[model samples]
Target: MTSTAGYDVERIRSQFPILQRELKGKPLVYFDNAATSQKPQVVIDALVEYYSMYNANIHRGIHTLAEEATAAYEATREAVRAFIGAPSTEEIIFTRGTTEGINLVAYSWGRANILEGDEIIISSLEHHSNIVPWQMLAAEKGAVLKVIPINAHGEILLEEYYKLLNPRTKLVSVVHASNSLGVINPVKVIIDAAHAVGAVVMIDGAQSTVHLDINVQELDCDFFAFSGHKLYAPTGVGALYGKRELLEAMPPFHGGGEMIKEVRFDGTTYNDLPYKFEAGTPNIADTVAMKAALEFINGIGKENIRRHENDLLQYGTEQLRQIPGIQIKGDVAEKVSVISFVAEGIHPQDLGVLLDQQGIAVRTGSHCTMPLMQCLNITGTTRASFAAYNTKEEIDRLVAGLHKAIKILR
Candidate 1:
């Protein structure tokens, strides 16, 4: 696909090998970006180079290969620090993904601080990862789990959220962007409000990191979590950013070799700040390759990508709105390149199958936000999320595919 626009959409698309392939004898149209992004050539090359040349353990190795591997792995941590505008690398800890990051904070910090009769507040716009861990933590700690309600527009009602916050509010966790509806919550206001009540907040950036600019310092969130795969890197690797004081105060998430200072029968001394939480060897190769993914995004500049994707989002939403019996979900101005809708007479899974037959990829389901689905009065939605490399042509194809699919379904 090509574009006659200010941005080089073709050049960006060329860097992704998967964009050139054919699915069902048709050019692939990838619009499932919120689920996970397609990696560029640089990222794939980094992975091969790491595994082929320097496949060694990190942080504890002295050999040449091990030193090289460890440097590459740690480089990604620095890159993540820069990507999120974090204060220091000491505050960043690598994890299996955003899910692990949330669980880490919940188990470590939640257990340490939360007391009986405390309240943990989450929003209606959270992914299952952000919701389940806190629910479990609140239950275990004899703390109450409360949800911030949303309006009919699929947005977190700030007024209602304020009403929920009290002196007893311990932790407030929320998604930076709604995965199912694509609404960007008013997190800054939410964070500041939570702080007013002496509550620490966690922002789940799984769906926002790639599409939006993130600054943990500017956001003033106590903890921030994001998945690497959502940002064009490989799966099974993500980062959690915590304030230094909070991380130091909280206990370690796991007990293992790397996370230990000295292990003895008497007592085990944990390692320093970040490493204390990172237990095992981790997904070393993927973590190393994650730097390449960040570099790729940095080269193009996030502002340019955002503008291009915003254009695509506008075009896609306009084209879809014209189609009959298609009701777009979360019809709001403040959002990224995500469009979720449900057809009047068609099931989301069936619509997805038909679109897949046309080589058009879209996510169809509750999108791991069952509570949000229930709140929105929808069983599921057909979500088409865009990335940096996507174009108006692909969205046109999506519209055409939807028209054909809807006709048959009706």
Candidate 2:
């Protein structure tokens, strides 16, 4: 399944078995990719292969199954390092998901480095996962949380961000791409600016990793987190990439097996770089499956996938704008294949329900960005997000479904 100069979208779609299923006698139109992507057959097969063939714990056992399982699991760390262009596998730490990854940094790094009167900065377009963990950390440490405002276009105010950075600013954690608006944030610029102010930056890459090319070293961000589920792998598996120095300095996020090299009643010494944070047995099956997902993305080349998805975004945006009452949110010039919009006189939930009945799936409501919803001066928007496997024909179906919903509601 190698990606070529000419993208074979139909061939690509054929690889995902779930895409073939019909919903209510109609072909499924999955436009809710921002929430989570459907897995390819290869990824599914990897999961089944792991359980059927190995089915053992990793890192501790000397037996054949354990050795194979450990090797496969560690192979994912290397795959992730290459996928994101991190310097070393030691920098990659597996966690439950983006939410858990963020929480780990907040608990480990935040608690260690932040002091009273220190400030952590984030943007207005952040998902609640990025917001709440920091809020909890700030409250606990007596540190202040500041937000960089966005324009109506859903972009972070660069000047405001600069003004917010100061000696007191200790961390700047922002999303690589907004889940709600689909705006691809200028994370490199954000990272550089934060570095100028001596602040460590953590990028929430859950959305961007699926649609954009990521190079951690190029961006020079101190930390990066993304979910495997969003990248077409199984749920409960994700990775956090942190600078080796920072990861080494931070305390262990969890206390349990594999995190300890030595333990006694009086004292305990933690394990090395990644395993210190990755406690317990871990999600072995899904972690192994993540390598397959990354391989799938690699086989189809990130640039090829990006180009196809960009076409979907452009075409979908143009077609949706033709509707009389449609108002698109986050009309940023630089964005991924995501469109959040509201139809006049129709609630987002109502529109979503109607679209679902027609076998078009879309995410509705605040999309876990309630603060962003408030910033947009709306309760919610119906979001149609695309993936490499999605087609313009599916976007057309989504547009038709929207019209049907409008006709019924209005």
Candidate 3:
């Protein structure tokens, strides 16, 4: 409960108005952060201010409101560029979410580059967003989709991954962190290996962008994708970061209004880099507020937040290990503040429902990583993930809830 290094968890908790609400009769304990984060008052204020003051469409109008709205929206692009260490704002393309970002690459870049019999490598740790788009692309292009295997600890086997690569390998797409298991993959190494085989790499940063320090240029990944909702912003906005050369070579994602330079009946000339991919009216309010969310994270300081969350992870893991018949999925040392575990006799769905009754919210089922669940030889696991505002006290409540659930279920 003490504020160390200027990080006051209680102060942070007060900023989130929803954290004060009760789910049942008890106080709320929201641990479903991997699914989506709760927004602070600052981010909420940004949305309200945008809609209340300057609610105009971006890029087209030179009027006062439009200028204010457009500047705010584009400020988010610069924030994302600095957040991920992208070379320029031109490489940062806005989308609906991480799913749309990957789909954008698969549709635009993958369509142009991939050939029949060419290979794409993904890992066992990927979320469905990373897997499905490539599956669709592979199906359409007659390309081979290969999966890099994982060990018993749910860590990627670098040796096995190397075996999957060849001159025929076209792209290597993977999740930087596993949403289900909470295992952080060695992506920098994966990127280098794929490049050795003359392949481009795309990282699914849906989970990593919030927890880990991401520098896409240092990682040398061709593309990176993440969502805004997961980063404590609104639901409808996210971003895709690609290399400048790769983005220029790839065709425009969608065709319409702002995405085009000139619209003639004979043919259309598309706009440059980012606008070319951003078709139609964008999620202006949420995208504008996303800048506030980024600044929120920066204000608290990521390393400072990571330390507190890591402490919570250690404490939670220690407490949960005492519960009988409980086995943690991906019981590895390398992970963010996420814990996924299966009980011997009880179903995960039952456990989650029991926790919810106590107002301790957690994610149940496969977490969109069904293939990972199948690989782990379980139906699903109950997931309790943490964020900056979470506390050791909440983990205690979760542990107590789990103890009660197991007693009743067994």
How do the residues 1-410 of candidate 2 rate in per-residue lDDT, one tens digit apiece? 33335999888899999999999889999999999999999999999999999989999999999999999999999999999999999999999999998999999999999999999999999999999999999999999999999999899899999999998999999999999999988888999999998999999999998888899999999999999999999999999999999999999989999999999999999999889998899999999999999999999888889988888888889999999999999987899889999888789999989999999999999999999999989999999999989888888888888888899998
Q: Looking at model 1, how many pairs of residues clash?
A: 0
Instruction: Give Cα distance to truth, residue 247, candidate 2, Å.
Output: 0.7
lDDT of each: 0.93, 0.93, 0.93
Q: Which ten residues in a row have the lowest lDDT in candidate 1?
A: 1-10
lDDT, candidate 3, residue 84? 92
List residue ranges in candidate 1 displaced over 4 A. Answer: 1-4
TM-score of each: 0.99, 0.98, 0.99
Name every residue pair that clashes in candidate 2: none
What would you estimate as the lDDT of candidate 2?
Answer: 0.93
For model 3, residues 58-99, the per-residue Cα lDDT tens digits are: 899989999999999999999999999998999999999999
**Candidate 2: where is the Cα deviation over 4 Å?**
1-5
Worst 10 residues of 2 by lDDT: 1-10
Model 1, span 1-410: residue lDDT tens:
55536788888889999999999999999999999999999999999999899999988888999999989988899999999999999999999999999999999999999999999999988899998999899889899999999998898889999999999999999999998888999899999999999999999999889888899999999999999999999999999999999999999989887999999999999999789998988899999999999999999999989988888888889999999899999989999899999999789999999999999999999999999889988899999999998988889899999989988888
